[model samples]
Structures are given as structure tokens and as C-alpha cells.
Target chain A: MSTPSKTLGDYVLGLADDALVSAQRMGWWISRAPQLEEDLALANIGLDQLGQARTLLSYAGQLEGDGRTEDDLAYLRDEREFRNVWLVERAQSDFGVTMARLLLFAAWQSELYAALASCPDPTLAGVAGKAVKEVAYHLDHAARWVVRLGDGTEESHQRMQAALDAEWPYLDELFRPVEGAVVDPASLHPLVLARIEPVVAEATLEVPQVAPARGGGRAGLHTEELGYLLAEMQHLHRSHPGATW
Target chain B: MRDWPLWEVFVRSRRGLSHVHVGSLHAPDAEMALRNARDVYTRRQEGVSLWVVPAAEIVASDPGERDAFFDPADDKVYRHPTFYNVPEGVEHL
Candidate 1:
């Protein structure tokens, strides 16, 4: 069977979009985190994600040989043009929900980046190598929270479990195969799950059993939340079009 | 849930150096405290190592006893090596 064709630009953009959207969501918790320390931690995590997004997006723009700069791709694109996973686009408000989402996202990212680090693409490999370290920290932060909140108080435990269950449907979306991509999402599932299952068990929490959400975010289709997210993220840049800070 | 107790953070920027006081954060346990310190204080690659001590466990000199605690050392100029002529080649004296 002949292999399908996939552009390196498109593949990098998908990873970029995931980090960019996730960073945006993570930034929302800066001042509103449960505690001051947590506020700092979450903000740092957001900055790391944003850094990865910037590098990947810039690389994507370069690979496409489009005259568009990183800012153009980030701010000028509409909701349908973004290629992030749905898992990062959901509105995450509650602390438990945020932790659950982060745990899964970071876990997947750690495995994904580790694999991509060895891929034939050097730019992709360099970006992935740098990103894997940051993602490891993110995964640790989320894991600690998951275990804490999952095993903490009666209310916290219940809420953490609910958060896990609510986010579980989105898990399968991360493992969906990408055709002709250097990184295989399906190959990452078992490794990511290995990292997650022990944490869940240690937290005295049960892994949720639920059907996977239908994912089309990789095809430039996202949840309704992405529309609102883009509106807020793009407003300033779009209003002044090409104005620098 | 209730707020975690405060932990004082110290970060050693490199090996073979002492961990210096950085700042403080709140965590339920020592493990989480160290992790929080890593996140909050070392985000900028500030340290190679970290130390977190429970604030409650620290023993501090009373500020009200400033004179009794630290004044005695002020007059001890003899404790300074300046009284002796330092040999030119002597280092870290």
C-alpha cells in the first residue's frame, strides 16, 4: 500500500495549535488559581506552553514558505483555520477540571514529544527535544494535583473523580491516528496511559469508562469554544493590524 | 479544603554551593512543597537544586531582642581579619 502524503508544515501547525490553545486556557488561571503558589505555578506552565507554541508556529510558517509571520498565523487566522485537538479547546473553569484536563494533555504531550524527538525531521526533532523537558514538568505538576485532589478531602476527591470522568471522553481524541505523520498518535496511547494509570491508582481514583468524543479538531474543525477563544485572543492584534507592542 | 501550611524555599543555583533562601509557598506535604518551589521559584532556570522547609519549623531570633541577639557582634572588630596585615598571596581569608 502506498503511504499517504502529509506536509511537514501541516503536521507542525497542528502541534503548534495545540500548545497555543492550551497556553491560552492555562493563562486564564493566572490570577484565579485556588492559591497564590498555584497561581504562579499555573502561569509558569502557561508561559512554557506559549514558548513551545511560538517556536513551533514560527517553524510551521517557515516550512510553508508563506510570507506570513507567527503573529499573522496566530492572530489573523479564523477558528476554522486552527488545527488543535479538541481536548485543549474545552472551557476549563473548575480547579479539578483543569487539573484533570492538564494531566491528560501533559501526559500525551510527554509521550508525543519524546517520539517526535527522534523523527527524521530535524526541526521537528529539535522542537520536540526542547518541548519534552517542559512537558515533563507540566506532567509532574498535573500528576501531583491529580493525586492530591483525588485523595484529599471528601469533596475534593468527588470533584476530582467527576473531572476525570468528564475529561475521559476527550482522551481518545489525543490518540487518534494522523496519516503520514512522523509522530503516530496511536503508538503514544499505551505509553501515555502507563504514566497516567499509576497516578490514578495512587490517588485512589478509578479510571473513567466512557465513549471517546468524536474528534475533528485536527482537520481545522474545533468545538464552539474555539470561536470565543479566538475572539478574545485575536481582538487586540486584529484591531490594530500589524501594530507592534 | 483548608489551606496548606507555608513552606520556606531555598534554591541552590549550582552544585557545590549552599542553597540560599528564595521565598515561600504553601503545600500540604514536603513532597508537594518541593514541587511547588520548583514551579514557583525555578521557572527561569533559577536553580539546580531546591530546599523547602516548613515555616512553622523554623526557629527565628526575636526581632524585639535585636540588641541582645546581634549588638554584641557589632563591637567585635577583632573577629574581622582586617586587624592583621593580609599576606598578598592569601585568598578567601
Candidate 2:
């Protein structure tokens, strides 16, 4: 059970990166969602994640003591420097797939945030307190979609099941060890699964028994997807230098 | 064929207020209709409560019958309480 101790800043940085990357992917749904309402839904969800990322990233910079601002950490870092799990970095081109991933990620985050809401670090505790509410809504929205699609027409059911199967392997990465996290990531495993299992069952989708993917995003090992995501997300910030909106 | 049914959204901006009609959205069912209403109408802190009704379920006076439905009320000014003068200390009135 021996694990290298990670700095608190690193722990917070991982949470920040998860939100940042998810926000970027969610932003892709703008103008591309299945309906206008869905477009707005994705936009709102992305904004929530973006807000969480901003606060966490800014706090992480302060904790690091290296004078790295939120922008510096977010826009300046390469793919290899990010600490998010692989679950969020993958492309979510399919709506069903997006819902499946959001359901899993939000479920895990809800538990993590709830546990951290009372932690020793005030900033992390405060961030987790607010984030818990947001993730609760996020999880509900995703679960509703997952259930609808999973129990809907033939085509939708197939797609929803496929989406669940596709994303299940990535779920394990979320429970990987984090030395400085307020709660054990492993402890959130059963809670997350319990949250997800009912939704999957209701949706009539099988909990995929696939093997876990090779994941080490916490240590900067990421899939090719992260590189493309970083390129697009950082492009404007890096290009504009000191440009003001 | 249209994919979903239309729903009329009603939102209460705060407590102790009647739900006001906000707008409409298309959703597969009532649950999603409520969720869509939230995403579309309540994104900017617009509402504290939301209700979604199937658009087909709401009955409305036909536009062509507007005069028949409301013309009678126009001549009845007595229905309004504006003519009454308030007493000297009738603060709330």
C-alpha cells in the first residue's frame, strides 16, 4: 500500500485539469447538439466545468508558490503536463457516448467533492462544496439522458448500450491513487458504481466487463486525444499573447 | 415525422409567485421536457421552480374567437376596483 506522496497542489491540479478538459470537449456540442435546448444544456454544463476549472486552477497556482497563474497553467501546459484521467480527454462525438461519460465522471466527482467539502484545506473544501451541487445536477441530467436513450427506440438503445460499453473501461482510471487527495480515490469506487449501476440497469444496458485501458494521465501519460484537445484549447490563448477580450 | 412532442414551459422566478409561461421545447417525454425547460429557460437564474406541460394538452381560445371571448369584458369596467378611493390610513390598499 506504499505510494509516493503527491503535493496538495498536484492533487488540486488533477481536479482542475479534469474540469478543463471536460469543458473543452463539452464546448464542442455548441451549435452541434441534437437540438437547440440540448445545445444550451451542453453550454451550461461546459460553463459550470469551466468555472470549476478556473477556481481550482487559480488555487492550484497559489498552492504551488511558483507564481504560475491559472492561464499560465491552463494555456501553457502541453499534453504531457496535464494530470486529468483519460475518461475526460477522449472525443465525445456521440450524444449517447457523451451522456455515458458525463454520468460516470459526474458520479465520481459528486462523491469526491462531497468528501472533500469538509477537508482541512479551506480552498479545496470551498471549491468542493460548490462543485458538489453542480455535479449533482450534472449527474441527474446525464442519468436522465442515459435512461431515455437506453430505454428508447431500437436504434437509441443500441447506441446507448454501445456508448456504455465503450466508456466503461475508462472508469477505472478515476479511482487510481492520489496521494494528497482529501479522500481515497479508491473509496469512491463503490459509491460511483452504485450511482451508475441503477442508471445502467434502468437504461437496460449491460455494465460492460471490458478490461481497463492503459491510463496514467495523473503522471502525464495520456492518449493521443489529449494532444489534439490541448492544441485546440491552447491555440487562442497562446496566439493572442496579451490580447484582451 | 417530428421526433418529439412539444411542451410549454412555465417558470416561477421566486417563491410566492405564480408560474409564468416561459417558452416551449420539444422532448420525448415529460421528464425530459422539464429538463429541457431548465436548460433553455432557467439557465440565467430565471426561475426557482419549473413546470412543463404537453403543448397539446393546453386549451386556448381560438385567435378567430378573440372578440367573442374578450369583447364582453371590455365594456365591464365595474370588474376593476380602481374607482374606489382608499381611506386615509389604508396603507396596503
Candidate 3:
């Protein structure tokens, strides 16, 4: 399929939405993870994602030239306006599911940001350079958890496998190409899959053989789950509009 | 699931410094314990290195022995280097 022609603002907003939505989902694990240590680890990961989102959103606002601040873009947009992939927007409560999603998403992000670090856009390249370092650690953290659960016990292995199966369908959406971006999403697919394959093998798990889900998140289409997610995410700011922290 | 074992964390902020105890956490194994300690204690770039020891393996002095174990050196002036006077221009001594 041919890539869509998008402005720099559109591209930046898509990247920002991915990190922002993923951070929201990750924040849900702060106090509910299996272990206390895991709670802190997930929270820290969420913080990293939040930081990346802030930078990307700020840059997007500048590119749009509409005087929309990052907060305005983040808190004022409706679900249909968001451009995050379905893999990040789906509601994930299972720990194994969370790890599986993170493993794939972070692997893709690691490759994406690494490539974006050298993009023609100076501001975008600068943001991606910093994000590349952070996402590398996120990828490592997710890879370790996937292995730990996938190889630990029979029950854990089963759950991990199931999680991977559930998340597999969303993988295709991440590789959908975008025109005018430094990184071609199509090119990143093999590199990211290669990174995940060894980790999956070490965990004694099979790469999922599911069909891909239909996705158009980059075109502002999203699953129903995003509406609820945005409602809760934007509730505080909407409740007290024009309020500053 | 059963809880993981407790681990005492120690961090060395820079080169030539000894690892000092910062805090503790729980993990399923040593590798995880080390990673957990890195996330929990070093998020602020507070350390250059980390050490995670199983809490059960740490042998700490008894709190009840505080006065008996530490009071003897309090008034031992004769054993102190301060009792000896330096002649002149001693930089580090």
C-alpha cells in the first residue's frame, strides 16, 4: 500500500499520541502489579513515555502554528482525533498482556526512534535522539519480563503465550508507512521482529500466527476503547478548564 | 503468587567509592533483584554502580548492643591521633 502524505505536525501528533496513550495504560499498573518492585518499574517506564510525549506534543503544537499548547492538544482532543496505534489504545489489565504489548511496541519504537534521530527535521531529530535512549531501556525491560514469564513456570508460559497471541494482530498497524517521515515504518518491521524473535525463542514461546487486525489509527480512526480512555484522561482538565497546576 | 525474597540495595555514586546501603526491595531472583534495585534506587542517576544482596544473607549488628559495642572508643583519648602533636606543615597527616 502507498503511504499517506502527511504534514510534519500530523506525523508528530501521531508519535505523541502513541506515547501518551501508552503511558496512560502503563500508569494503570502502578499499584496493581504482581510485586511492589514491578509497580515502581512500570511507573518509571510510564514516566519515560510521558516525558517523550510531552516533547513530541510540544513540537507538534509549534509545527501546527495554531497557538495550541501541548496541554490543549493533549486534554482537548476527542478520541477520533487521536492517532495512536490500536496496540497501545486497547485496554490491558493482564500483566502478561501488558508485557507482551510492551515488548512489541517498544521494539518497534526503538527502531523507529533510532531512525528518526537522524531525520531532516532538526527538532524532531533532537526529540527522537533522546527518546531512542529511553526506549532502548524500555525494550530491554519488556524483553526480560516476556522471557521471565514465558519460561518460568508452565502456567506462566501458557499465559505469556496467550498474551502474545492476543497482541499479535496489532503488530501490522505499527509498520504501516507514513510519507514525509524520516523512518519508513515498512523498513522497521523486519528489524523489530528480528529483535523480538531471539527474546521469544529464549522464552521458549512461539511467534504468534494470527491474522492482522484492520487499523487506521494514523488516519484518526481508533477502537472504541480509546473513547473511554480519553474521557478519563481528559476528565480533570475538562472539569476545570483554564486551570493551571 | 508467593512473594519474592527481600534484597538490600547498595549504590556507589562514582569511581573509588564503596557501595553504601540505600534501601531494599523484593524480587524472584538475584538478576531481577539487581534490575529492580537499579529502577528503584538509581532513577535520578544517583549512582554509577549497584549491589543487591539478599536481605536474609545480611548479618547486621544487634540494636541492643549499641551502647556496649560503641561506647568504649568514646573516651579513649590516648589511642587517638589527636594526642600526638605535629611538628610543622603536615598536609594530609
DockQ leader: 3
Tens digits of per-residue lDDT, candidate 2, A38-106, equal 999999999999999999999888878889999999999988889999999998799999999999999
Task: Give the Cα lDDT of each candidate.
Answer: 0.89, 0.91, 0.90
User: What C-alpha lDDT, on a 0 to 100 scale, does residue A163 get in candidate 3?
Assistant: 98
Docking quality band of candidate 1, CAPRI definitions: medium
Evaluate residue A4 in candidate 3 and report its C-alpha lDDT on the 0 to 100 scale: 36
Compared with the true structure, model 2 gives a TM-score of: 0.95
DockQ of 3: 0.77
Write candidate 3's Cα lDDT for B1-93 as tens digits. 466788899999999999999999988899989989988999999899999999999898999999999999899888877877788988887
TM-score of each: 0.93, 0.95, 0.94
For every model in order, what is the iRMS? 1.6, 2.1, 1.4
lDDT of 3 by residue, A107-214 (tens): 999999989888887887888899999899889989999999999899999999999999999999988886456577899999999999999999999999999999
In candidate 1, list every pair of residues with a backbone clash. Answer: none
Question: How would you encode candidate 1's per-residue C-alpha lDDT over A20-107 as one tens digit per residue?
Answer: 9999999999889988778988888888899889988998788777677789889999998899999999888999999999999999
Model 3 stretches with alpha carbons more than 4 Å out: A1-6, B64-68
Candidate ranking under TM-score, highest first, comes to 2, 3, 1
DockQ of each: 0.71, 0.64, 0.77
